[model samples]
Target: MTIFTANPHLLSTLAPFICFIVTVICLLTSIKIMRRYRHKQVFIILICGLGTAAIPQLLNAYAASSLQAVPESLYIISTIAGTISFIIINFVFMKMYAIGIRIRIAPILLLSLGAAIAIAASFLLAPYEIGGTKALGFPVLDFYMFILIITMLVVTRHIEMPAAYFISLCVMFSYQIALMLHQYVFEHSQPWLGALVMALPVLYYFLLFYLLLEWIMERLLTTYQSAILDGLTGLYVRRHFQKKLAEMIARKPAAVIFCDIDNFKSLNDTKGHHAADQALQQVASILRDEVAPHGIAGRYGGEELLGAIEIDKVKPQTIAERIRARVEQETIVTVSVGFCTTKESAELASLVKLADEAMYYSKSTGKNKVTSYRSIPAAYKNKA
Candidate 1:
């Protein structure tokens, strides 16, 4: 066989092999991701795209490298289809991963559609006349690839994901741009230069997929963390704090304080819920400012708050009084506090009860007072 007869098919064969390897890697990675992270949306899209990718790669290989007869139309269709499919998969993957984060979906759709159109136009508008490159057979695939990169970058900026995904995408797009530049610079004398340059995008894509998966996992973890934090006060909520206290009990020392508003019902009835809410915010801020240095403060419920302080020697009454005084000075709305501590107590509910008793004791004496279980007068409790 002449060198010419053997050569034209070589590019086709190698392209399929490269694509197959990428497909298999993606398939295995998808399975691992589903098993490990259980990201059903991402896994399905990737798997479907990877599968679609395999058929084109195989067809391209057979048409180029093997003696088997295949239609040129099939090769062109596969190549275009593969590119479009991959771009769509990536766009959807990003949107799925950025659940809470806001993104502009309309642009992403337009960009991906533009890529599909560019690929279709390349084949449909090819020059019918002989030796005509400019009239209709102009190369438009590069433009599509460039636009795809730009759209992906724009989409990612709006979504909150790990830095690695962005970095990987940057690398992928940069490599594509460099490849395009390399082709433009050395189009003749080395046609294989184009293929080599193009190889970079494929290679970078493999890296990009893994980085995207990691970004999804990181985003999930961050979302979970946010769910446990109180939005208004920047503190762990009652449920989260209760869980933490349970864990702390199995380990070491802790203290608990429960606070309630003095005549808070009357305050809400008089000032409206909005003003009451503002007062609640003020109380939270004061507690955070005064007690958070030594502990954590959270709004337990309406007009009631709680604090957990870790102390080796400081008494619970001291922590309670510090918070009470600061809260009184911070707001026109006054609060009563009750506190209890035990280095060995594991049940937070027990401490909460003790603190509640002390708080009621303060209410009985007067509004805007801090009382501790240790300081409660026995006769004062009997009246209530």
Candidate 2:
């Protein structure tokens, strides 16, 4: 037999532990969706958590069962891996799964001190004897402390999450804590303890399962929003605006207002493209804030914004005036606005034409002015 396989019972001893480790890895693999993703940090931390639990168990088993037969190098590597994993879990918990930590010396010092103590206790301390069986017992204590510290962190965070997330966490935490209690306090080294200990990894797996679904849904929503939103102005793109405008036309006495930046192309030429883009973004912001309460607003191509508001709540002229005034005040740019209100049913194309004609009237008559569709000159209407 080969040196590594000399012990016939190694498979018997390692199979269950290896299976639990596999379960942990499977949790990670299942959640790994390349296109639809969220919280990469959490995925990494979970891998750390798995190693923190699994590596120590595997090494401790080898050390206790075949201390004389196993190479000393294997034992040393286990000690290093386990000690680092233990320290990482504590530090990670304190940071609350965030990339950055607050400026607090106490948490750092506390982590350093705990890591030092755990490393020393695991490597230097004597094995615990129970029922005439010799065992390196430091890992059990270290992991129990891990559960306690993370639980404290959870409480401090007030478990603030969606109802689904909160319930999943609570259920998993309850199962894990109960299993730890059973394994450590009531029956150490029991065959049943080994089976039940698998529960901890499984419970955590379920928590991650729920979290994976949540992450996917959030990603899909974010992607959908991006698809519909204009990149520069944070307004709905033309496609989405067309849909919303059609709906508004069918649903109510809707008004459409079109506003165009005065001499926008000249501004782009004089002030540069960067300044022009900034001006457009600023104008879109004013339109969004002013028009959102009553209706929807979106970019209708460059240097122009469109609002679809139900005229009963507020007139399109009033909404257009607010937007024009705000743009003049908040930005260096001014806009010419033309609006049309309809108390009766009107086709979307016709409404847009009326609003556009009025806006062109303002563009031709005066640079910064508000014009209504009804006020457009007869010649302008005929031309339109």
Candidate 3:
């Protein structure tokens, strides 16, 4: 056993420097998770957990070395904080991604009580000797290891995890278990590298940071998409659709179809608003089916839908007829559609005006009809 008895310069600087780096990384990641997801209490708990383990690592670094070990008191206290924080993180992850997992207080109470009892045992069982030298906190370390490995297994097994996460976690926990077991065997039997092995759990801590970052990115993307998309109809809102339409107009020759439900107000009055909403959704579904592969469909207003497409690729009349046939066939309602394709008119407002005029012409003559702006009479054009 080659152990440096004098001031071990390399060991001293390398160990603490590594722990410091881990602390900073954990703190920075937690802060980002905190600021972006401030509304979530899990982030607060996560930050606290990360800091709890990190702050104690500086003390732990000193505890490591060739000749001396960290005080048992400092060691056990740090372990307790870290163990509890890990449990909280486990709980929150279960709550977040584990569908149908029980969140009742029983599991938490059981785990906390178990950890507390084990930690206290470390305190009560102290002042012992390992290999004829004064030692402490080893049993507590061992027990805590048991609790963590088993708990992580139970957590990931009972709940569903994404395949990548599950595999990554499995690899991480495997390394933790392997390192701890090596420490347990060699702590009493031989001169060990206390500083390096003891600090390896921080490597696992970094993996936790990775998981949190991935979750936050997924959450932000979902939120942004929800903002632009309508929850009820799964269509783009007017503002986003308008923005996209302008972009499309700039790219190629574009056309638009504007449609409104026929006798929508009467249907709402007679069949109740529920049926009216179903009718609108049905019309949206129909429009959505045809307006794709170079097109967009959106809710222009209540009971109104607008479909936009590239005139060079897709004929405007094709989408309008598909929607008309589908709505009349599938639902108890019908639509009045007006399609406008103008190479000369480039502005969105002008296109909408021409479409809306033709749509109103259908409503005036009779319901359940499709009209093109080119088909409207000169007198009606003057009125329009």
Q: TM-score of every model?
A: 0.68, 0.60, 0.78
Candidate 1: stretches off by over 4 Å:
1-74, 97-117, 120-138, 151-169, 188-199, 206-219, 222-234, 237-240, 285-299, 343-348, 382-384
Reference-based TM-score, model 1:
0.68
Residue-wise lDDT of candidate 3 within 1-384, one digit each (tens)? 011112355554455546556656867777876776654566676566567666556554554443366566665676666666566666766666676764555765677677778767766876334445554434664556565766677658756775545654565465455544444456434224454443455455555666776777888888998988887788899899989989988898888888999999999999998989888888898888888776999988898889999988678887788888889999999999998876737898898778888888887889688898888999989966
Candidate 1 residue-wise lDDT, 1-384, digit = tens: 001012353453465567567667767777676676654665666666667666665664554466554455564566565665657556656655666633344754676577667767866876222133221112577656766778778967978765656765676577556645443444323556545544554565566567655765776787886887777666678898777666655565677788887877888899888888777788777777766666677767767788877766567778778778877777777888887776434477887677788787888788688877777777765764
* Candidate with better lDDT, 2 vs 3: 3
Tens digit of per-residue lDDT, candidate 2, span 1-384? 001112234443454355345545544553465223354564466456546555545554454356343454554445455445434443433343333553344653565466556656755665433334332334444554556456644754653344554554455455455555543465344545544444444454445445556655776787999989998999998889889999988888888888999989999999999999999999999988988988888888988889888877777778888888888889989999998876422888778878887898998898678898887778777876
How far does residue 375 in candidate 3 sit from its true spot (Å)?
Answer: 1.3
- Name the lDDT of candidate 3: 0.70
Best by TM-score: 3
lDDT of 3 at 175: 47
What C-alpha root-mean-square deviation, in Å, does candidate 3 show against the real structure? 4.8
Ranking, lDDT, top scorer first:
3, 1, 2
